[model samples]
Target: MIVVNLDVMMAKRKISLTELADRVGLTPANLSIFKTGKARAVRFSTLERICRELDCQPSDLLEYRPDEVPQNV
Candidate 1:
């Protein structure tokens, strides 16, 4: 599974959602989806823009996490 650490990066950079959206040329609603990990897919161009604005790499924003099984199940 992939995890998005957009909120973490945004906090570290002291950037608001509106500010980042404006800088990245994306709508706040769209960026919110990405920030919240609700996005099903993201374009490379978009990722590049975000990384450029955040001054970070894709690896900083994305993480590979193995899915955890439900112990109760």
Candidate 2:
């Protein structure tokens, strides 16, 4: 399962969800979905905006952790 590090990043930057949404020109509801990692897709432009506003790299916003694959019995 993919996990969002938004809470962690926000803590590190001391930025609130509303703050991030305001900076990124997105609605708090939309940003909240992204923040919670419930988003199925993200636009490149949006990603760029987010990175710029957050002063962070894409990798900072996202991470990959390989989970154990289920094996057939």
Angstrom error of the Cα, residue 63, model 2: value is 0.6
TM-score of each: 0.90, 0.80
- Name the top lDDT candidate: 1
Q: Which ten residues in a row have the lowest lDDT in candidate 2?
A: 64-73
In candidate 1, clashing pairs total 0
lDDT of 2 by residue, 1-73 (tens): 4555777777788899899899989999998888877787789999899888777888888876678342221
User: Candidate 1: global Cα-lDDT?
Assistant: 0.91
Model 1 vs. true fold: TM: 0.90
Evaluated against the true structure, the overall lDDT of model 2 is 0.79
lDDT of each: 0.91, 0.79
